[model samples]
Target chain A: MVRFEDISTPARLAEPGEGIGRDELSLATRNHGLPLEALRYDLTPPGLHYVLTHYDIPYAEDGDWELTLGGHVERPLRLDMDELRSYAAVTTRVTMECAGNGRALLSPRPVSQPWLVEAVGTADWTGVPLRALLAEAGVRDGAVDAVFTGADHGIERGVEQDYQRALPIETATGDAPEILVAYAMNGAPLPPQHGRPLRLVVPGWYGMAHVKWLRDITVAAESFTGFQQATAYRLRQEPDEPGEPVARIAPRALMVPPGFPDFMSRARVVRPGDHTLEGRAWSGHAPVTAVDVSTDDGHTWNPAALEASDDHRWAWRRWHFTWTAAIGTRVLCARATDAEGRTQPLEQPWNRGGFANNLVQRVPVHCTGL
Target chain B: MVRFEDISTPARLAEPGEGIGRDELSLATRNHGLPLEALRYDLTPPGLHYVLTHYDIPYAEDGDWELTLGGHVERPLRLDMDELRSYAAVTTRVTMECAGNGRALLSPRPVSQPWLVEAVGTADWTGVPLRALLAEAGVRDGAVDAVFTGADHGIERGVEQDYQRALPIETATGDAPEILVAYAMNGAPLPPQHGRPLRLVVPGWYGMAHVKWLRDITVAAESFTGFQQATAYRLRQEPDEPGEPVARIAPRALMVPPGFPDFMSRARVVRPGDHTLEGRAWSGHAPVTAVDVSTDDGHTWNPAALEASDDHRWAWRRWHFTWTAAIGTRVLCARATDAEGRTQPLEQPWNRGGFANNLVQRVPVHCTGL
Candidate 1:
């Protein structure tokens, strides 16, 4: 786990909480991402939702943990979890994927928590928007970045510091790809495994922008050059180049119909006959323009039926592909394009962190009846 | 597991050996394939080798299993394992990939044993060549297909029968991409996980071509229409379209020097510096004509150093790409073309069975020290 750190200050010592034990370790214990097989449905069940974390899930006690708005703000303010709850709340369902999704598939895989194709999930986030928080704090002129701090902290690449990341002030203030300081998940109070009392839910960006166990929101004058913004979660050309900061989940799609396992299973066994394949697709960057499936290994593709889309920009739209299963093994594949024509590649463009692997998904099945 | 059944005769009743219990069910328990991360190394260790099976690893006593040659031959012959060993033996290092290697990557994945990119491995096979055995059996006129039968059997899609498959007679007696009834792996006696007493090793083709637990070879005058051949292992467009029978390993390449996972990890994280990236490439149809790597996705590609060529047609040649790792997330990708000029597609043409997923490998890595 790469904990974004601010080494400029004395490192905040980690407070004691429930540490995950070896016996309790699971993909979930490590804050596992959503298993592909879990996508076998339209609405993602809260328990089945994917989870990605940059550090251990922090245990927070309402009395000890608080959200403070300071730095370039005219009125600095601090509020305990209870006090923060007094603000009006809104609910939005958002799909967030780690920038590092499909990292292992990359050649010369980047180092970090080895990730596969999971690292993504969707949930209904309930809380106050950063705009509301920033308004109350009264941001002063020339606030360039909103530096967010989390309760999680650790040593990253030999540097000890607290988990922190920053968003351009414009993003924190903008309404599109909305930013939320969430206190609940899927209609329930956030679990400790998630952010617990509070977490930043940046709808469009990768998980790195969503600071979990969020404790402080600082409006800063200069661009925050904390390790994460300047070093980690970036696409670089050379070892010394802190290329582009990894941002928004790229255009992509996924489908989970009933009967798929919780993990990748080779192909589904079916009687020789007609069958319908269905799933969901979404883009953090733009609306999904098209969803397609190929029964002939992509030699040809058929457009799938998509459900009516609503105003929720971050929610994935459902789709379906119907085909017949002959007596033999068959490969089924799906791909999606966004409003800007951003479709998945046959291969995901590689990044050092293996982020945003939106490669076309291929599925194989066997028509056992002969 | 989809076992081939030959209802033509009373089914070869399954003899259980280490049957996997519900608690033991796992990718490994169901005769799993290699994990993609294991491909980081050139030569797959016997322990790390991938295993694909249509049925449970049957208990084949050497005394009970024998190779029998009959039908359209000058001399019908049967030989026990020891007797078969009396003939001259040759050893070859061959890399075999399951036709279903990248099945899960396909959308609406075909139903079968779910396999990802790790369904492949390289191993040293020791045995007598089939051409030599065919020579001894003496080919009679009118022989067209060499129908091969295995000892394992079960009801597949409701048909009770023995496992069976066939190959063109010319391939059975040809020299390139040699075929062998192997008895040993990596110089050790074949374990039950592999074919215990004897198994066919058809290098370059998918695992289905390598019929396990060999029992009989029947030289016939027409194509064999067994379920495994006529129905399964075929790439189809429509259910009625037999499409094409999947054959020969498609041109493909994989590389991981060391310090990678047994499965796909996000990207290999490393300190920024110059690093030598290397691995192996192979083809069943034509010799690997060329291999190219791109540090910057597919925008540009540089040829890597391929090991000196040799007479071994099925042996994968090693290649190396030396480049510097810059900081942040970077993508490394490799693509291979064969002698026939068949290069991996930016997307492998899709097929119903999800066979021949030889798409280029894309690797992601993080240069952690920035």
Candidate 2:
């Protein structure tokens, strides 16, 4: 049994030369990433999309579930699934990415969910707008933040509580991004792993802000400082430093490996010929404006054609390039630049939590006879 | 670039005290196991079901796909999706477990997919029977085996080829244990991760026998030797020995951890009181007859109530046990017995490939105040 003090110790990076442990492997087996090749689909199939669950997927029956809107509200309300679904609904395509998407790639990696660039996926979510519900509840005077709590309860870093994260009052009541209380994914009811009855979908923010298995929303008069927000998803180099809270995703572009993979090594093998390279690029801050592909590592690059960004602005944009291959082994890389002029970096700054590290992706390929 | 000779090196057990490599971690991120808590549902959700893809999920268009049946068949034929769907279809709920489900738990674990139980799920698969398709093609006399090939192509152990596996002709054409040319899962068209257009589902066999993205069927007059059949999925202790091929899944039982889990260690914590333990048990060899639960780490055992097994005989059966908890740390274990009197072993013998290791499960729980 872990002692109480040991459980409360702050998160730390893996020791130098340390490898992924059994604990991290256990978490990896439970959570999955979008297979890099799945980028071919515009709206990733539900099962193929990435998933990251902090605790057990709470077993819930829709008929017995209820969402309570209380705490510093004009009028407290509790609504069942049917009542919640009665509101006017809208469907929107959004790309969601975990805050720790590239955690394992960091030097002296954070020993949590060991992700390596596959932690992003786009989907069409259907639900009632969360701002509509907040307007109906009437956020009382002096409300500073809104806390959304999921039914999934567990102990994290010694504190035992329901999983939760809070959004600033203006963001919660904002009209532009269109926050949603989603109940369906792609066209079907949310699967157990995606949270059954209801979940919060915060567009343009990291996945931590999009709480799943949502059961309660409390409008608070003070800034909400939950363990997830204050302790876990922070960008800090030292344990004692209070770092910036992670939010919007950084711009990143990932390609479908050009050729077949070696089953054990995953090294690509492509015959010498002409090939069409396609991929998806996205950013939570703004629409993507440009994508660049590199055949000789990052030494030289060529611009790729970007798709029109008028539709699905909050989702990924398709990009493509044509390449003529020669007989040799080479490294392929892709980088994206958003409308706000934020381009992916060749190297990402390291942090204790390893949140939002969008280092460029490099795929090794062998150009030889198949 | 990987040397050709290095690519041909056989898979070996991890060096003593060595950790999981980046290659294995990359594979784990792409594939996933069912979260143990999902055992509560009778029909596991599509997204929560465990998936293992040896190679990439081949891109397929149903309208463009055609299944060819030839080789030793007296009447070689090709059928498109519409024609294949016109035949009589049957839906069956089968519990499928990976042959390497408990691989990581073995000492000196094999350096492949590092699975630790949880690599099992039950789903309702719908499609036309393979025997019917075989009858339509009319197998010729002296046919010894049938080879099924998938569209996923890759290099494994220095051999570049489309993934292929073969089954004895008698088993492929058998009346009992019906095999399916499946095209749907859980009432929906096959998801890309599960195989897009078509797949093979062999009831009462480990998942290795179920080929995904199936495209071709060839009947042979001699026993077929393929890499997946003769090399990878064998139970041998020596590198050069050709051991028994892994076919049927051994009896096994896994319980949903009784209480909430620690986010990192996954150690269960429950308030000191009476608690009910629930789990699922299955065996591909025969129907599971009894399940025994032990709170003292297999030292003392108590019988659990088993649900009716007449329906969904090929699927898992639910079992439950009530335990009164005391404030302390305890180990929980569950073991299953099949109708053929085959019970799970307390410890599994080590093998080079780490296939078919179904020892009893041990869950560590802290029965203290939450």
Candidate 3:
């Protein structure tokens, strides 16, 4: 029999000249990215939204489901679906992106899910505030974290366990960024593919923190070092290094390709003349303040008009640019700057796990008369 | 300037020892497959269904959209969304599989979308039967094919054009297998990713035949010679050889891997005990009549109990087998046999385009105490 504690290295960069592996291809086939064209919509339709499921989408009947709050909590409670839905519901639009969004684009890329720049989406979620539940459960003194456990169980690296991740107590119950136990998406009951019945939704954070198929919320007195928290989703240069944990999503901007694409290569072709280029930009750190567009690669940048409002503070803001095209091959790029003054980098520093590498998008287009 | 007709080879295999290219990886990111665990659902959720779009999903408002039927039809007609919906609607469950489902599994695989099974789903489609529309338009006596043109346009292999495919006139108006102009899926209006407003759903055929973002139906006096119909999706051994066209889906069965999986490799780990091996089997040629299960790869097979019914003529059938697990490592496989005496091949013949490959699935698992 194999020992349970014999775990292996958590993250490794792909060897030189190594293309995407079959295992990574398998993950790609199962999870999907948002087509950059889908940026046209303010709230992405569920089917068009990018998805990254770490394990099997757990099968659960909502009627028979229960959520338990225990451990360091003063009042341990178990609530069924009906009891859970009894709480007042609030709906909010939030943009969520995977930490590994640009993994495949990295040099000596990580050998995990091979994602491009499309692994991001904005959605309207409806649920009860997590703060309300925490208050009702009565948190005890000295509770450092609230561990959320999902029904999805699987092995990661060499350790087998249910999917679990913890949030600092302040972040979990903070008023500035309301955390939710969402039961609905875009006004409809959550579909099976998107953590049906119920799921956790943490605004302004990367998708990994929003545990799906949630079953338990255990208030803990100490930091919880689960496999997902301390192992996989981290930034490190070497195998022995204890990397900084990945948390909030980095600022990013993506433009809708201005013209039709080649079927296989996806190279764009457009007619010369006046055209309006539009896209969406977001930052989990702060509200997006400015967006810049470049027609001749990143050599020169022009400020674009931003359509921002107080209503979509946690969601992506729309931006547009008008250009008079000439002809020949050209490269287009877009970059965003958040209110915190953090602009998207042209080239991100490489890390072993390939987390939060939000490099500006570069699109190639051939302009000519159609 | 690039000439419009300067086309290259329609299909080419990957160079020996070369891994999947970045272009193929890009396609994999945009498209997605049904997770094997999702077989538990009877009608697949739209977001989880396999999607393979050759070009951008055309944006069209339902109120202004129209489908034109002309050429060789005695009474040419243009029908708006309202007019189309006024016809009697039929709802049918269909299991659609991509023609290139097992493309990546082949040696020197075709360098396009790198799919490995999982590219299949069953859905309840609601729409007007194609025969009714064809009868109203009155197909002319000399008409031999009904050419479908979708609004999605792009360049494939150096040739730029709108997406187009064709069905024999008889097949388009046949009673045995009704084709539809589908507008709704799973009782809701079709999502944007699934060709919102209107699309063609050809029952008992590969997904390529179900043209999405449909804009026109032109009856022709000759068979279509479009790139998708005449070049791509064809089964061939050499690039120079004109091969047989890919149409119906071949017989195939996939088991839901027992127990949990390793997050990276996706290899299953099960506790040593009795487990029910369950899966879904399907074929476009005919109803699935039998299913077989093997624990030791394909070395030995045992008959499985099929839960088939005439109600789901064009949909997949459920199958189950009981197995006792007490092993270190095991490879489980499932195979299906259709009513037409066609059984899934143990090993599929290699083809240039990788179409209609139905090799039995092999799932590696480790059975031990958790």
Candidate 4:
């Protein structure tokens, strides 16, 4: 078992020496604390994984933190941290990733962070159900959306900036216990960098919706449009304009491309004999139903053993496969299929920034005597 | 004229005491910089406005930015910032608002920015024509989505993060100069916070499509997804599930609601006397053909003067009306009708995280001695 000391925090400070431009870190290429060669099973070894958040890291504050739920509701509420924790606690092992994972791999390598693959990670999260609070608040009819805000602030276009995003009411109060108002990560109180007091853990979706340092919950018939909603997280192009303002387009939610590959194409160092290949698979909208591995690119394929599905359907599943090959150079690949019948593709279509990269996993490896 | 120095830089830092909640800085409430009273105008002020982005602020380098056009074209090439800027430059004043503007005003205020009512803004933007770039780049048949990415970075959960979004091809290569690769804002170099080196500015739609710090431009047949596309800025609960996970729902682009009010309500803070009221009107799918104002809270109404339309068909138009009232208190309202005959409603349907809040505008004013 890997010890906690072996877990290296992937967070890096934006320093001058760190070349700007595409050199910045991105979801697709940030190096986690684990070897890219090792393919683990079940839980993502804390070292080799991805992280997600909605707002900037909250400051360390011990002040009284309260969550208020009001507006159009039968009964308004103000729940403190302790009060919220006292309620039934639920734990879920889910896979959470940034919406833009795998972006760096896009051909032409979009201008954002030149992520060298590995933009996702899975963790067992623990939190309270948001629905219970809504039930306690007695939701009223016409409650359209729920707005979540965080404590971090910055300067955007020289204006005071605070991050905010909204979720539909149905999702906020759904039967699935996956939507969590979380306080813990990987079985520990969230660190200051990861929304200490409170944050949201929304499985199957990108990290943006899981707001950090969550402070207020308001039920409304209308949607909210703070900086994050109206301007920051939006598309700006015209529906028929055909490449006028490349960015100006209608805002749509992030999606895991239907044909995206589920597992990472990786190789493990092995002796010149028999060996097994392993990896993991997950989806944003559905559960990982199966994983397939390819030994010769797409020329041939074989089924891999998949771990049991986790409590959170949005989380990813671990898988492994054994194969014998002549010691030499080989191309390895993996693919995933979700419950919705979506499967990984051989290659992803090229986009400007490489948003949803679900292309088949391909890794080239050279064999040496072990 | 508002002098540059006297104008306060059109930006401000967030106050320390500001609460940490989505609604605290939402456009809906007066406290969030977007005052409800400002909605009386048809054209949103430049200072009080909305902006969108795909990546974090890019490091503003020299004229290092370039525009590339290739794929199924006669010639594939790259145009640096100077080369692209050498082409003809055009300027237009337009109103750009999030599709979910006024979302917070909904009954339950869906789960988005708790906008208290101010998610709209107008700006005088200058940029190069997209047609020129396409002509220089060359077009292809199978091209479907034009993806955009930025240089911003953050940590979500425990991982590094980057922002990205995409738009359809038709919107990328449109006829009108509505789409712009903007380097200047309000006739000056765009501040770093607003897409410094370069950005896409498509007027008349939600903000997500306008990718900031744009880097790459790809022509493809399929849409990409990271977190932003598949999860964050989507509309679920269309059929209205009260408490479902947001991921289970399919994402739909922002749509103009049916039966919306034609004109925004107007009010004059003056002694009991005759005064003229004015505001703006427009639609997402169609232009605003006319607007009508009501002083009796919808009981009676009068037609307002409509301004000539602009090149940006999706832009809102200014309208005004004169009315007489007795001393005391009065409620004013307005509604708008789009070219397609869709009218604003007295109240918009509630969704989770209040999106698409286009209800009729109602203003309450107190009258004094004549």
Global lDDT scores for all candidate models? 0.69, 0.89, 0.87, 0.54
Which DockQ-derived CAPRI band holds candidate 4?
Answer: incorrect
Per-residue lDDT of B103-145 in model 3, one digit per residue for the tens? Answer: 8998878888999988999999999999999999999898999
What is the full ranking by lDDT, best candidate first?
2, 3, 1, 4
- The candidate 1 chain B region of ten consecutive residues with least summed lDDT is B6-15
Residue pairs clashing, model 3: none
Residue A29 error, candidate 4, Å:
11
Best by the TM-score measure: 2
lDDT tens string, model 1, B1-370?
3433321122111122212111112232233444343455455644345666564345466777778999989999999989988989988878888888766455645544445466677878889999999999999988999988887654454444577989999999997667898998878777665677798998878788988888899999888998888877787866678678888888887766222211112224556678888777888888897889888866799999888657667777888888887666667788888899988876656777778878777665655563
lDDT score for residue A277 of model 3:
92
Q: Taking the tens digit of each residue's C-alpha lDDT, what string does model 2 give over B1-370?
A: 3465454355877888778888789889998999999999888888889999887888888999999999999899899999989999999998999888988888898988889889999999999999999999999999999999999988887888888989999999995689999999998889888877899999889998998888999999998789999888999989899899999888999999988888888778888889999999999888999999999999999999999866887899999999898888899999999999999888776898888888899998887764
DockQ for all models: 0.02, 0.66, 0.64, 0.01
Candidate 3: where are CA atoms >4 Å away? A1-10, B1-10
Put down candidate 2 lDDT per residue, A184-286, tens digits, no spaces.
Answer: 9988889888888789998888899999999999999999888998888888989888899998989999999988877887778888899888899999898
Candidate 4 regions with alpha-carbon error over 4 angstroms: A1-41, A45-49, A52-56, A156-160, A230-271, A310-312, A350-353, B1-370
CAPRI verdict (incorrect, acceptable, medium, high) for model 2:
medium
Model 3 residue B183 lDDT?
94
- Displacement of residue A304 (Cα, Å) in model 3 is 1.0
Q: Quick one: best lDDT, which candidate?
A: 2
